[model samples]
Target: MTVRTRRLAALLAALSAFAAGCGGESDTDLVRDTVRSYGEASAKKDYQRICDDLVAKELLRSVEAVGLPCELAFKRGLQEVKNPRVEVGEVTVNKSKALVQVRSSAEGQPDSQDTLELTLEGGEWRISSLAKAQPQPPQPAAP
Candidate 1:
């Protein structure tokens, strides 16, 4: 075989090895994407779309827990707001569970941060919990 041909074969083998090593996206990435999609739907006031992304039990529980008031709030807030943006920050995953931090802003208001916990079930990611990002207390009103 020619020297050039052997070098080409070696390059192809290295490329294949790298590709195999990288494999596919991690579970954390999947959960992040799912949460982002849900947020986008919520921002659009597309309750049906948001509901479609949630697990059955979560959907039922959310409806019962918040009742119709939640739906009304979404409709009112989302409909009035234009160009909402949701940013998902660094996500950490352990085993089949993961935590994703998100920041959302609408119009020109301050960004709201929250964390979402997720689990991998049935080959899909589902939100298990959500906690609001608490702001640090303001410095004691200038002595």
Candidate 2:
């Protein structure tokens, strides 16, 4: 092959590698998407969908430890609220673990904000635990 053709081929390969590394979405995006899906399911009161996205017993135990009444709360909350909206903000991903923040509002009232911890298992991101995000401390009065 001509030197010019070989150089062009090498350049294309390098560009492809770079694009795969930086241009395309990373695993963090996948985790964020999973978190969004969870919020959508909760807002829609789709318990099965939420369960499908969870990591089963292990995750459930963690959630329960934090006093999250998964089945009952989801059902009751869904029945009480109307037209819920969930906004996902801030995702931190480290290797196979991630934390996602979600703010949910129901019936035009701000409900509660939560952070969902997740992990990559069997090539799929699953919720490991759900915890209420602590509210920011009040700012001091200015002098």
lDDT string, candidate 2, 8-104, tens digits: 9999999999988887667878887887787677777887777666554576665557676666655764767677766778899898788888876
lDDT of 2 at 64: 57
In candidate 2, how many Å is residue 26 off?
1.5
- Which tens-of-lDDT digit does each residue in 1-143 have in candidate 1? 99999999999999999998799777877877888887778776786655556433454377548656445645654677667777899899888778888876667555677787777777778777655687334346776
Please give me the total number of clashing residue pairs in predicted model 2: 0
Candidate 2, TM-score vs. the true structure?
0.63
Which stretches of model 1 miss by more than 4 angstroms? 1-23, 69-81, 135-143
**Displacement of the residue 78 alpha carbon in candidate 2, Å:** 3.7
Note the Cα lDDT for every prediction shown.
Answer: 0.71, 0.75
Pairs that clash in candidate 1: none
